[model samples]
Target chain A: MINNRVFPWLDERLGLTTIYKTVLDRMVPKVNWWFTLGSATLFLFVMQAVTGIMLSVYYVPSPDKAYDSIEYIMTGVAFGWLIRGIHHWGATLMVITVFIHMLRVFFYAAYKYPREITWTTGVFLFLLTLGMGFTGYLLPWNQKAYWATTVGTSIAGSVPVIGDFILRDLRGGSDLSGVTLARFFSAHIWMLPAAIIALIGVHLYLVIRLGISSIPKENE
Target chain B: MARSGNVTRRGFITSVMAFAGSIMGIVVGLPIIGYLVSPAIGGRKTDSWIPVGKLDTYPVGVPTVFSFTRSKINGWEKTTNSYSVYVLRGANDEVKVLSNVCTHLGCRVSYSKDTDTYACPCHDARFDRNGVVLSGPPPRPLDQYESKNDNGTLSIRVLES
Candidate 1:
């Protein structure tokens, strides 16, 4: 009785009833555990954002102090190890889920017709996720990070005429110096996150607009 | 017509609510913007003289290992780090403090007395007594801290890369 009265009041004030009927009253086809991968990927992204924020609180981006700061976070800060571990594992899990989601969409022919834009956005999001991984890998500033980045950027330098340009842009110079660390730190923490968030907005909007695709059947 | 000239009840309330919301957003957003941009705009590293040890303790004509604890504050995080360096004292009382980190890949380089060189265990990079790169994949010489001998105490100013 109270909900009836309160809901009417809210609907009268904010038009909530109209929004609920339009957005929440939609029909969804029968889906199994496979359908949950997209939601799982979304959940992992949120987890990454939360843990990444906590990490940014203690992570220093300089060449001089980056590794030490991570060590401090792992050993010194309270519950730091758990949070960092979650962030690390969450990133790996997100990549896995996103790949699975893409495969499910492709194999079911869900990307056909109206869902082409959705598939394209998903591809972009996949590349951005990989970019996030690559950039975040270098922020630790360990021997592995330093050498791997040197090797990674050198591969970028192997691309035809634009190779050196891409390499210099990525490293911020001819050599992997402090500037590279700072640049990667900024890209990892700020620019990529911002881009991912914006892309996620579009991706979610498209998903909702088109509704979830049903699994392909043997017969029509 | 006169009733139409007056604002509707819903319109007046919504206008007031929107104004309040804008004010709230500005109040919350300003500090967040400042916090995000401060690290990029602020000075890179804090400059200070770290005291290593006494001049008398460092043996002459030998690379004595000295480890010192330095606290570094970067934005919101503060870390107390123990760093090692090789301090070689000359006959004329001049001191050379070489950073033990290899120039190749930032691994800790240890002094091998038998080989008379600082060798990195990670990549087999070697540096001679003068901190010059001897062999392997090191691109440059080992880094050195600017050391100062004040009276009988030794202090060093760490250079940022």
Candidate 2:
């Protein structure tokens, strides 16, 4: 009832009808459920945001409390284990979906022609997702996180001339300490998420603007 | 574009999208609500009997300040808190412990033998030997700790909110 009465009135000013027609109501190419991966990846990102925010409620970024805080979330807080489980798995699944979605586009030649920019953005999204995984992996401050990050940064330090700068920049110093944890946490929750969200906005706008590509047929 | 009597291509796509979107919503919606509100609703109280020292160590008719460290779990970290209290020894083996925290702005209050009154350096709030507010802007008297003596050892029951 509210939609029938209020939608038209609001749509006049907001162009809701125009958006619906152009964005959702337009005819897309006939495709199978493989087309759903893009949407699925988007859904997983939303899940990441929800669960990540919930985790941040109790998560401490400091070296002393980061591990214990996660322990507290897993054991003490109600439904915290479930939220974190979803986030952890959702991140893994998102990487898979985005990668497969890119493959699907490549196979169909959907990245050709007018979709070049969209394809470029999609690649960036894939790399950013991996970046998210990398940054997020070190937040728990356990033996795994500490050693893995230590080895990971050391690899960067092995690079040519600028290796030392890269390693120091990543760790916030020569060693992994409270500052390193703080930096990773900031990137995990803030910097990487911002980049991903902005890229996603561009990705979706292009998807809607150019319309999804159709499955290729035998050439003449 | 043909409707085929009822459903169009656009209509079918919209419905399927809606269904899938709702599935996403239902999967993560409920648990996230419970997760976000869990900490705010669940809080634990800490209380203990903190021992001061031998009862005779505090001289009679004078208030002596004693401070100690109290550690408790604040979320994921163990936070150490400093708490000081004034121990007053009255006649007839009566012992009263008043929190050294000023009732006005939470500054430490010290006992001045010259004025014979507890003085808060922050706001110059003064209290009598009994810890009743005497002057300045303290709306209430200094908070008292329930104390007892066991074998000449004085301890106070501390309840933290």
Candidate 3:
């Protein structure tokens, strides 16, 4: 028998086995390539996590030396640039794939009554991915990263009365500096990931619960 | 009849064949897919200082853009790649290298000799002589790099931070 400790009461509370069965048996269609993008995006997330952790081992987040440190990783560390590159490109690609997946849903009108929550949750996840991308881009603190982010956040500062408040919260100051790095670091590593993972679980759960919609025929 | 058993056996064999084909296809296809997508997925490995070129190749009082490659690592793999740099030989004969990025809005800065400044047309921030903030909405000075010259060849290491 499997260890009760492994499965535990949490599994029962989550209804893990039943949920899995319903998802495998009912929801996910044994279709062609259209369904695979979601899994691919999830897989890319795992890749980002692994590569990002490896990079963090050597990344020092400070404006004074963030650029030098990244250079050192790219030049001195064994596989540093590779990890950074993967993190960089993987982020963009994830955003693209998720966008296409959403488009696929929209084109098919899959966001009908029962699936609205799924669509909404997916939208939240999409925004979170973009958040991850934007925040993570600043961690390098290169001129490109620094100036690009400065301009990007300045747009946030244009949101009327609350714009300054939001911009200050984002940069941690009027200028992008040590505090800004810290804020982006925290967002990239902790806050956004936590939010994304939690929502993803809910999203998958809803997908399982609702079951996959029949492929929308053009006429009907 | 004897033919009925043969028909059942044929159906069973066909099902087995399809299942085996799918399993084998997955087994074969996964590694191929992983390999093809690994660069974007895992990242390219990089290391070492990329060499730019000879010092005399750039004239004093002129800005020359040079490019080089660095090796990067992602997990167990390594990749060497090219990146660009903008080097300015100042009027005072001192070599100053800056990232080709504008401080005001992250646009590429171009040398404008008539104005004697690096100007960002995006938002009108201008840096004169030593990358100091002169006008417009730039929060800081343009970035500078550590440069080296040996045997009349000038080389620089570019950082992505």
Candidate 4:
């Protein structure tokens, strides 16, 4: 065990006093499963970041070579197939896990009153995850991928007066092609990630500040 | 009030224990999660030349079946699988390799000698020797591979979709 010697100036201004720890002790329940979801989500996010980086190293986002590049990984590159497979399944798993975590929070009525900001941030994060999945799906530009995006963009185009504009913005043209792949790649690898990380940081800070919700009064 | 206060103290201690337990759990569970979720994130590489066999063995103007085994490590674990492709030598002397799986839904297609086109028995889809979609529900051309010639051997790398 490592010894932590209290430094001279450390305990003064930052309130290094264990008072906050005591407050957390008084508020949080001991054996509740609801509390596990937050950490689990964080775990999955870290896994996503690492695996996503690994995949980006070999993934070609260009239209001409994207399909072939993926095939090369599957058939020729060292452990490339497995890496791609893991990234694929990992995404599906993240979606499932995030949804389940949301449900847990909802059922516990953890989103009420003081936690409104946290809940709202969480809802945004959830949507971002879905968007990430959607954008990432088209990067392969395979048959399933191509048609799926076509269907997805058509749905976007169905959203009343502005739908066509949204579809055009997404596709960068009338049809899904090279421009669209690059757009999705940028959104998947950069834009969404930046947004999600910032939102997650806020969510966690709020959680730490407010503490996990106390069980609804009579429910115990 | 004394009993209520004691109960609160007990609850607090339990929360602390739970947090500690969760930290341990995360340590143990992360690698498992990593192994399971790593596949879909990366784009696949189909950039290398895969050997299809001898140039002489591939008779001119006929489709010949070729296959190779691919094994890869995902995380620390290794797995292997077999992939097959159909190759045909055209009159122009260019060798073409096409995925045998039908483009519509992945059923195997065959060469109809009389028609000189590849036909999918399941869907009646037809493609010329080059795997071009001649008719039916196939939305695009048959998937093609990048071909290479090695010291009298004709090899092709199947590009992944």
* DockQ computed for model 3 against the true two-chain complex using alpha carbons: 0.02
TM-scores for the candidates: 0.57, 0.83, 0.54, 0.54
Q: How well is each residue in A88-171 modelled by candidate 3, as lDDT tens digits? A: 899999999999988878877888989999999999999999999999889888778888899999999999999999999899
Of candidates 4 and 2, the better by TM-score: 2
State the local distance difference test value for candidate 4: 0.81
DockQ of 2: 0.65
Candidate 4: where are CA atoms >4 Å away? A1-27, B1-161
Q: Which residue runs does candidate 1 get wrong by more than 4 Å?
A: A1-11, A14-25, B1-161
Alpha-carbon shift of residue A44 in model 4 (angstroms): 1.1
Worst 10 residues of 2 chain B by lDDT: B27-36
Which residue pairs clash in candidate 2?
A: none
lDDT of 1 by residue, A81-177 (tens): 7778988899888999999988888888899889888888889999999888889889989999999999999998999999999999999999999
For residue A80, give model 2's deviation from the true position in Å. Answer: 2.0
Alpha carbon lDDT of residue A127, candidate 3? Answer: 94
After the best TM-score superposition of candidate 3, give how far the Cα of residue B68 lies from its true spot, in angstroms.
Answer: 40
Worst 10 residues of 1 chain B by lDDT: B31-40
Highest lDDT: give the candidate number: 2
Q: What is the lDDT of residue B18 in candidate 1?
A: 100
Tell me, per candidate, how large a share of the native contacts it keeps.
0.00, 0.88, 0.00, 0.00
Q: Which stretches of candidate 3 lie over 4 Å from their true place?
A: A1-30, B1-161
Clashing pairs in 1: none
CA lDDT of every candidate: 0.86, 0.90, 0.78, 0.81
TM-score of chain B of each: 0.70, 0.74, 0.56, 0.63
